[model samples]
Target: MATPPSLSPISPPSPPNTTTTAPPSSLPNNTAPPTPPVTNNSDPVADSPNGTFANLLPPPPPPRSVESLPPGTLAGLIVGVGLGALIVLIGAGIFVIFYRRRKKKLANNYSGAAPQGVDPQHWQQSVPQITVLPKPTPPPGITPHLYNSVEPPSTSTSLGSEKPSNASPSPVVAMGHSLGTFTYEDLAMATDNFTDSNLIGQGGFGYVHKGVLKDGKVVAIKQLKVGSGQGEREFQAEVDIISRVHHRHLVSLVGYCIVGVQRLLVYDFVPNDTLEFHLHGKDRPVMNWSTRMKIALGAAKGLAYLHEDCKPKIIHRDIKAANILLDESFEARLADFGLAKYSLDTDTHVSTRVMGTFGYMAPEYASSGKLTEKSDVFSFGVVLLEMITGYRPVDKIQRSLMIA
Candidate 1:
C-alpha cells in the first residue's frame, strides 16, 4: 500500500542528425520545431543573456503571506505594538502641556482655581464697607449722665455694714473734651513767643530754633518765613519725604505745624556742627586719614542706601560736604533734603538747571545740564581729592582751572 513519489520534469530528447529523403510536404506531420542535433558532448540548453538560470532544477518558494506568517512573527508584532504605544504616550504628554498652559491662563483672569499654588480664599476680593454700631440703652434705675451722655454709673461700697450709695460722677473727667490736640497758641507759648536767643541756625528757607516742652523734652523747630509759599512748600516736602524714610544716617522728621501760612518742621536735633565746619575751620585741628576715611565711608553708605535700599530710588541732588552733619558721636548724618529728586523712572541723564555748588558740579553737567549718578560720583571725587590735598575745589588754581 506504499504511495509513489513524484518525478522531476524533463525536456524531450533531440533526434539524431541524418540526411533525410522525405518530401517537404511531410513536414506538417512533425508538430514540434526540430531541436538542434546532439553530439557526443553537445549541450541541449546553452547559456543565453535572457536567462541563464531559467533551466534551473527548482524555482524559489512563493513569497510569505501575513495570514500564513513565519514562526517568529509574534516577536515582530510585539516590537511594533510597543513602538506605537510609545508614540501615543509622547502625543498625550504634548497635549497635557498645552492643556495646563491654557488652564493656568484662564485661572489667572478670574476666580483662579485648581492644583495651582494661588490661594482660592483671596481670589475674590470684596469691596470694604463702613459699619456703624448703635450704643446700648441704659439699664433700670440708672439715671442718665450729665455733660457726657455715654458715661457709666459708678458704685462704691463703704464696708460700714451697709451698701454705700454711688459717689458723684468724676467732676474733672466730666468737664473737658478728650481731644488732646495741641493748638498753634500752645506751641507759640511753649516756644517762648519765638525768641531770638532760641535761634540755633539759619538755612536757605528759614531759621531753626531750639525748644523745650513742658515735659522737659528738647526738640528742633524749623520756622518758615511768614507768608512765603516757597518756604511752606519746602517745609511740606521735607515732612512728606523724610517721614517715610527710615535710615540711620538720614535726619528724621518728628512733627510739623501749618498755622495760617506759618509752616514749621520739627526734627530730632543733631548736637554737633556740619562736616564743612570741621574740615574748614582755621583753629580746628587737621582731620587724620582715618577720620577722613570714616567720613567718606559713611557718606558712601548713605548714598548707597538711597540708591538701592529705598523703595523708590531717591537722588540727593545736593549731596555736598555742607549737607553732611555730625552728631555728638561724630557719626555722619545726611541733611538738607530740599533739592532731592526721585530717579525711579529712568537711568537716562536728566537736564536740569545748575542748582549745585560751583566746584562740585561735573563738567558735562555744568556745561550741558546732563545730570546723572555719575554727577554725584564726580562731586564725591572732588570732595575726597580736596580732603587729601588740604585745599578746596575753589582755591586759587582750582578757580582758574574751573573758570577756564
Candidate 2:
C-alpha cells in the first residue's frame, strides 16, 4: 500500500499525457482488422486513382517480332504460292494436250484399216486405206464414191449411148488420193482458155494442152471431148487405176476437174514427147542402139510392174509406142490408162469386148477377147520387133510380113 511512485506506475499510462492508439494485435478478440487497398504494378492505368476508364479499355497486344523477319518476306511468300499454282496448271494443260493428240493419232491409224468381221466390199466403199486430206464442199449430184473399183466391161450396156448422169463422179481432190481439185475457170485460165495453140498432142481420151499452173508448174491438161460415152469411161478408168499405183516409169496424175459436162485431167508434163514421136516422126535422127535398148528395158519394167507388182494386176490393153511417154532423160513413163483392166488373182483371164490397136493385139486376145498377161507379153514382143526393125507396127507396105 505505501509503494513509491517511481517504482510502481499506473497500469495504462507509461507516462502522463501519452498517445492512446493500440497496435492491431492488441485489439480485443471480438473486433476484426480492417482490409488494406490493393495496388497493381503490371497495369499503370489500373493502379491509377481513376479505375473506371481502365476497366473500359482493352489490354495492350504483345510486342511484334518485326526485327526477326527478313526484308520482302511477305512478297516472296505470295509470289512463291502463285508460281506453284501456275506450274501445276501448266502441267495439267500439257497432259491434256498430249492425251488429245495421242488419241487422235491412234484414231487415224485405226481408220486406215479394215475392221474385223466387216465385209471388205463395204469397207472399201466406206473407208479407203489411203490417207485423205481436208476436202472442200463437193458439187451437186457428187457422191462420196471416189476410188470405187470400176465394173468389168462384161455388161451389155453400150458405151456410145451412156449419159453423164449414169456415170460415177470422177475423182475429186482429197477424196481417196492425194490430188488437187481445180475449178473449170482456174484450168481455163491456166491453159489460156484452152486454145488450139496450146495443144501439145491428142489421144483417144482427149486433147492435151501444155499449160502453166497457178503455182508456176508446167503441166499437161487433158480436156476430154464432151458428150462422148467412150471418153467418160476412159476418164473413170484412168482416174481409178492411176491414182493407186506409183512407179518411177508411170505417169503422175497432178489433178482433175469437173464442171457441168466438161471433164479435164492434169498430168505432169513429159518434156521429150512420146516414144512414137521419136520413132516415127517426119524428120528425126535415128535413135542409137543403147538408147533404144534402154527405153525397151524401162518399158518392160513398167509393164512388169503393172502385171506382177500391182495388187489386182493391171492389164494395159493398149501398151504401144504412142502410150509410152519419154521425159527429159528419155526415161519411159507409161501413160494412157484409159483402156486398163484389172485381173483378179483368182481369175485366169479377163474377158470383155475386143478393143486395142490392131497390130499390137495378141492373137488369143484378138480372136476370143480372152485377155491375160500373156497377151501383154505378145504385144510387148511385137513392140520389140518394131524397135529392132525400125518399122511401124502396121506398116502400109509390109502388111503380109508380120513379125509377131
Best by lDDT: 2
What TM-score quantifies how close candidate 1 is to the native fold? Answer: 0.51
Residue 89, candidate 1: alpha-carbon lDDT: 100
Clash pairs of candidate 1? none
Against the true structure, what is each candidate's TM-score? 0.51, 0.60
* TM-score, prediction 2: 0.60
lDDT of 1 by residue, 1-404 (tens): 99999998887888667676554555665576666556554332454455555666466699987676676897899889999999999999999999999887665533213113323431221111212122223222434332111112211121012111123322122111111223345446556866888887786778888777666667677777765545544554464346445566777666555333345666767777777888886799888878888888877877776666553456666767777877876777787665555554345766666667788878888889776777777877877776677676776755555421
lDDT of 2 by residue, 180-294 (tens): 6677667788889879999999866779999999889999999888668787777767666676566778888887776556668899999999888989898989999998998
Per-prediction tally of clashes = 0, 0
Model 2 RMSD vs true structure: 16.0
Off by over 4 Å in 2: 1-175, 397-401
Model 1 misplaced stretches (Cα beyond 4 Å): 1-191, 227-229, 345-347, 395-404
- Judged by lDDT against the true structure, how good is candidate 1? 0.59
